[model samples]
Target chain A: MKPLTTGIAGIALLAVLVLAPLGLPPFAMTLLTEAVILGLFAMSLDLMFGYTRLVSFGHAAAYGLGAYACGWLLLNTGMPMLFAVFAGALLTGIVGLGVGWMCTLATGVSFSMLTLAFAQLLYAISFKWTSVTGGSDGLAGIPRTVGPFGFAALSSKAGFYYFALACLVGGFLACRALVRSPFGAVLRGIRENEAKTTALGYNTRLYKIAVVAVAYGLGGLAGGLYAPFAGFANTELLFWLLSGQVLIMVIVGGAGTLVGPILGAAFFMLMEHQLSAWTEAWALYFGLIFIAFVLFAPEGIWGLATGLATGRFRPASERH
Target chain B: MSTLALLLTQTVNALSQSALLFFLGVGLTLIFGLMRIVNFAHGALYMLGAFVGYSIAAWSGSFWLALAGAPLLVGLFGAGFELTILRRLYRRDAHAFLMVTFGLALVVGEAVRLTWGSDALQVAGPPALSGVVFMLDEPFPVYRLFLVAIGVVVAVAIWQFLERARLGLLIRATSQNADMANALGVDVKMIRSCVFGIGCGLAALGGVLAAPLVTASNGMAATVIIDAFVIVIIGGMGSFLGSLIGALLIGFVQVFGNYYAPDFALAFMYLVMLAVLVMRPGGLLGKEA
Candidate 1:
């Protein structure tokens, strides 16, 4: 009964998010679009880090790769938006698979560092490879094509907002379904205890690689959507700092819970907006808040709420 | 030949660069090895040391006092951070600690920017160390030689301390097996805090020495830390000797790479790290066990 109520509440919140563009001003709609895309990106990261216990610090690589793929396809091949988005995500998945193979060989800090190193390499390539990536100026003038559902137009702010909303909803639903499946159970098992899962004859490494690929692919989809809407894809997306931001969002919102990432993404974006507006030294304040969270609410907002409701702040099964 | 002189100059430059790299890399390696924390704010602390040194020297017109006082001040700040924020994160996973420290780096960078107003500043070398020294008929900065000497002496001192001192043995034991060391009444927590302070102080000392060579900027910390991490990883995470060798190798690689393709030097370093991992997962000087 509690789960059902939570599910209904989630749907209500998502409905509000989807309808927000209808009534909000143009600038507000644009912010909504960014929030939706970042929310999807955050959700993709949590799928692997939260469920699989693989701390990846190179997701920006996949995101950048996807954006470039879509931008490249649109400019060179004049492909449709629908085909371009999926194609971009496919290319990102391939790259993710390759990087994940290398990452799965190591664990703990080495694994995190390897992913960061690989991403850094990609960032360097993107910056140097001017012919393809626009050499830091980024690819501009990305054509906004009609939506796949045959909507009348999507070049307008409201149209694109709706388009972004659809993508976020689709991605969020797909993620929820994926986690509820048998594969997700195995991933959870692997997260809880890799040794026991390996002992049970499950190929833990392969599962990790596969899930990472999926998560990266989804993240790439978000990036691909972002390119047409924002009309540019820069090398900055490949930076490790962007990856760090995603991790912050995941941990800040509460990992493992399906709705947690959405809340986390909204909160992170909103906090940045408010803090930066208030002072030039917001980064310092941001750091202080993050430190406070690490010390006090390490379980994050959703974790804290669930803990309070259940009257168990320290669940043995949910030990980080 | 002029080409010969240039080649010799590059080699001399590489040696000095290696010293600078070693000074920072060794401190990072010690922290990572001893405390199991990545210390992402290390570069920021280094920057602070440089700024502190420059301020003191500029005010008092005494480079010598700045050399000694900068590191002490930065070390106290590092110690305070460890006690106030970092200690609580000791039991958290490395990823959490990494995020926390990364946040700390951001905080420190912004604070530096607020204090310095984002302007780049250069520190002047002391009069005695100013001017050029002849290295096989090629002129090299004399301060560069001083940096190398300092690096060598510090490396030797650290090597001796880790090998001969009682605290060093405890650190080694704690790093290898924290539980066993705790069981043996080694005061593991105190050792970790002290090691962190020392590690941070070493980074500050490097910054003090490096201030005259490199311009102080808020943005340099992140870039320097990335380079330092590459060197540390290549040298083996916790090995002091590994850091020295790795820094020299990386220094040469950077010099040669910049000569060949200036744009790809950083990428070339990553490729080298990948190659090392493939050939030997334990890193160059890392233990196989």
Candidate 2:
């Protein structure tokens, strides 16, 4: 999408999201909060996957670490929510820097497997450290501290929803600026042809590692929000299934673009909510839809929307 | 138990576990070797085989029949899936294959839950192998011994088939260069479907063997798949010898790690895998990427 059109569409969508809580019931308002938080998570993935073309198979590591750290800080310390969240994100970024550096040594599927291995290690520790993580039952009653001035908004459902919305929009703009900057152009070059980029004396590995850290930092920010919003953090947050779930949202919503994955996340959560309410075997239906999208609508929802606008439908494969 | 008995029992445990891991890893390696597509549904196929084995054994009143029937039926089902869905996907890149197989895993997993229900169901060890044996005054189930023997026999048989048989030669040739083999008159598509079926069959075989020990449940796939990934990474993806060696090493790590460091057994395995991956991305015995 062009900058002007995407800007307009984004504002219009933001307007709708802002007003949605007024019309929604308590349950729906809560669900919307969950969706927005998840959307931010998916957008973080888009930063690496869509732009950098790094298919991280274990992104949940960053998110899960953020959740655990944020939960731990809130429960054990008297830090404000905002500070705790920032600390969590910063910690994940540092970890991402190290893990990403090591993983970037190998390319393609090997890189993916390396990422997965690290996440599995974290999952193992989280499961075993019962005292710290609550093991299987997970950390519970995570206190949500109210803001810079001890405002009560962080404690309420509607208030948390707005806070999450602000984070999403802010994160989105940060991502947009990152992708449009010269650093982002280097990332795109590396994504397209790393060998050529390297030949151009661009230190492609450093760029790749940089993006992974930035991407995971934002992912941590999203997870930090989740711990407070959900009032708990579980081992499942770090599981590979969540990684796959977020990846599906990014790809199916339309990778290579900033806004696509957020929309995809909202669509997925809403559909899951509706389907699971009607049938226990909703995954069966969801899987079928997912398979169909891979087989047919390979460009994903955003691609279909843009294709319709241009009035030129094309069958595109899964290409970076 | 004495120290000798404890050592003996854990060795047996590790060997049996390695046997099951071999069955899962070898097939995955074969598929990866030929198609370069990791079968995410391999674990689901294993779980499905166990569930199907349970139902078959329940109906037939024989554990042996399930061992034979589960793999055969699942293998056929895998072939059908290949012919229908995967045939069209060879044109796309690796990510598409991963996503599609993941979708397949979800579908198969949910389908199993719907068909067999969510509760774990036990499959009795065959009565012929149900008797206990003592080693150093420690009683051991003979069925686990049978699993080890079966693993060795399958490994040897697969080795012979690949190293000696005409079909094995054809498979090797195709894996080396599919287009060249196709140009020379080998049916490439047929070879792919056959390999995929064989891989799924091996996974099912592992599942049937494991059912007696672990019981049939949906979560089995989640646990085993992670093990498979660790093994694949350590053994090197697409390397048969690498998988076997990797599986045994992991089996020991998991068994002994559980004994010595019960808190971080899984972590131990991953740490080993990470060390191997960092040192040699192609795996211990596998070619360097």
Candidate 3:
């Protein structure tokens, strides 16, 4: 898409999100809040998987850590919401560096397995360590204080909704800037041909680690939002199921496109809500839909939408 | 029991567990070795094996029938899934394969839950082997010893098959370079299909064998897939011998870890995986990509 068009579209979407509360009921407003948060989480993954070619199968570890850390802090301490969220994200980023270092030792399947194992390790910790994590029950009754936003600015439903929307827009811009920068060119370089990137004297491993930390930090940011929004944090967020779902959001949205995952996350949440209401075994149908996307619409929902707009069925195929 | 007796019992316990691990991990490694596909649905195939075995056994009143029938049936389904669904994806990149297989895992897990009602159903061991044997003045389940014995036999058989068999040569050749193998007049497609079948059959066999101990449940696929991959990653993705050794190593780790520190046992297993992963990213016996 043209830069002008993309920018205009982004602004238009932000405006719509800003005006969403005017139409949405309280329940729908809450869902929108969660959807935007999930979109942020999906965007975080796309930074690595879509851009850096680092397909982590254990992304839930970062998000879950963010939620747990943020929840624990909010409950145990008197910190406001914003600070706790960023604090949670920062901790996740630091840990992500360590995890990413080990995971980056191999590429493809091995890297995926390493990430998965590390996530399972965290899951086990959360499952057993009842004193801190609340074991299987998970940390609950977390405060929803918006921190510096004061008691009224970011505490209520509308308050959190605006906060989440602002965060998503902010995150999208930050990621867009990063990807447009020289560092992003290196990530694209690694994605296309890591060996060539390395041959060009770029420390490809270092770049991989950096992207992982950044992506995971953003994932933590989303999780941080989630804990306060949901009024609780739990071990289910740490499961591989969440990782797979977010991955689907990325894939079904359109990998390598910043706006794709956000749209994908929203579409996914709506579908999930609709499908589960119809049948108990919604995952069966959800998996089938995901498979269809992977096979037929590899570029994803965003790709299809743009293709329709541009009179091209396979827009990504003829791109640079 | 004395320390020596306790150690002996634990050793036997580890061996039995390793037997199941070997079946599950070796199948995964074999498919990965030949096709470069991780076969995430292999765990679901294992779960299906147990569920199918449970129903068949209940109907026939024959544990032996279920063991034989389950693998055979599930194996054909695995090959069919490969031929019909996965075959279209061979030209795609590694990530595509990963995601597709992951979708398959989700689909199959849900299917099993729907079919089996999400309950853990017991599949009894064969009456002939259900009895216990006296060991170190302690009674040990004969079925477990049977598991250990069969595992060794299957391990040796598989090793020999890969080393000596003509089909195995085709698989190894394809794994190295499919185009070259095809140029040599090998039916690459058939071999790929058959290997997926055999690999899934092995997983199903493991499931049938494990049903008595763990029971057939909705969560089996999720848990077993992780354990299987842990063994596969530790052993190396495509190495048969690596799978065997990795299975034994993990089996011992889990058995000993549980016996010693029950709370940290799961964490301990992952720690071992992490340590090995950091030290040798390709795994202990896996080739560096």
Candidate 4:
């Protein structure tokens, strides 16, 4: 896309998102907030997956950790809301660094499996350590506080929606800028050819670890937001299924594109809501759609849109 | 039970658990060895097998017949899946295959849930195998011993097939180098389908054998798939011997961990996997990365 066109599109979308709550029903607003939080999580996965060329099967670990951390701080210590979220991100980043260090030792499938193992381990801890994590019941009754500078009480639906929207937009811009920087160029190089990048005198492992930490930190931030957004943090938030769901969002939205995952998250959440309301066997239909997407629309919904807009067939590589 | 008796009982339990793990792990490794595709639906197939076993036993009133029939039916379904869907994905990114199989798992799991009402279905062992056997003053279910024996026999049979059989040679060749095998006039596609079927069959067999112990349940796939993946990782991906040793190690760890620290058993198992990867990233018997 042209720079002018992209800029206009971004601003227009931002306007729509900012003003969406005024027109939307209360339930829709709630869904939008949840979608935005999840979109942020998906974007974090995209940092590693779409750009860094890593497939983490355990991305939920960072997300869940952030949520639990934020919930714990709010429930136990009486910390401010924003500070607790920040603390959650910081803790998640550190954990991500450690996990990234170990996971980056293996590439491809092994790396994915290793991440899965670590995530499952965390899940087990959360599920079994009921005294601390509230077990399967999850950490509930997290007190929502006023936004920074006492701007708005996030306990209110519209207030929380706008706060989540702000976070989503800020997070998206930051990720977009990061991916456009020289460091991101190096990360892409590693993705395309790790050995070649290494031979070119780049420290690929360091780049990978750095990217993983950033992505996971962002994922944690999303989780922290999610806890108060939904009024609780459950073990399900940390489950591998969430990781898979976010992955599907990334793939279905369009990997390597910032706007795509957000759209994908919205599409998925809306579809899920609509489908479940229609039928109890919504999973069967969801599975079919997922399979169709994998088979036919491998580039995802955004990819299809871009392809149609450009009037040309740009394979996945050239688009990047 | 005395300490010695308890220890002996746990050992037997570990062996039986090892047998089930081997069933799940070997199939996973075989398909990975040949196709380099991780069949995420293996657990779903296992669950399907148990459900099938339950149905057949309910109809025929013969646990033996269910044992023989369930794996075969599931294996056919797997083969059909491979030919219809998976074959189309072989040329795409490896992740494509993983995602598709994951989708398959979702479909199968939901289908089973809808069909079986999401409740755990019981399948009793055959009357003959329902009896108890005494070992060192500890009474153990004969069914468990049967599982252990079947596991050992299956392991040996697979070992021999891979070593001495022509079909196994073809499978090994294809796994080692599909292009080279194709050039040598071996039917790579056919071999892959067959391997996939066999792998799914093995998992089903494990499920059928395990149903008597754990009952047929929807939740089985989630737990079993993770354990299967751990076993494959520990044994080293794509190595039969690695899978055997990995299964045994995990079985012992789980059994002993449950005995010692029930709360931390799963965590302990993962810790061991992490330690193995730290020491040898390829797994215990996996090929060097």
Residue pairs that clash (backbone atoms under 3 angstroms), model 4: none
Native contact fraction, candidates in order: 0.51, 0.60, 0.71, 0.54
Against the true structure, candidate 1 has what lDDT? Answer: 0.83
For model 2, residues A20-81, the per-residue Cα lDDT tens digits are 98899999998899999999999999988889889898999989999999999999996888
lDDT per residue as tens, model 3, B1-289: 9898899989999999999999999999999998888777878889989998999999999999998999999899889988988888887766667778778887888988888896789788898998988888988999999999999999999888887999877888888899999998999999989999999999999999999998899888888888998999998999998999899999999999999999999998889988898888888998874
Q: Which stretches of candidate 2 lie over 4 Å from their true place?
A: A317-319
Task: State the C-alpha lDDT per candidate.
Answer: 0.83, 0.90, 0.89, 0.89
Alpha-carbon shift of residue B240 in model 4 (angstroms) = 0.8
Whichever of 2 and 4 has more DockQ, that candidate is 2
Query: Candidate 3: which stretches are off by over 4 Å?
Result: A146-149, A315-320
Among these predictions, the greatest DockQ belongs to 2
lDDT of 4: 0.89
lDDT of 2 at B60: 97
Instruction: Indicate the docking level reached by candidate 2.
Output: medium
Residues A196-295 of candidate 3: C-alpha lDDT, one tens digit per residue: 9999999999999999999989999999989998989999999887887888899889888978998899999998998899999988988888888788
- Cα error, residue A277 of model 4, in Å, equals 0.9
Q: Write the per-residue lDDT of candidate 4 for residues B6-117, one digit (tens) a residue.
A: 9889998999999999999999999999999988888999999999999999999999999999989999988898999899888777777877888888899999999998
DockQ of each: 0.58, 0.73, 0.66, 0.66
Summarize candidate 2's per-residue lDDT along B210-243 as a digit string, tens digits.
Answer: 9999999989998898889779878888888989
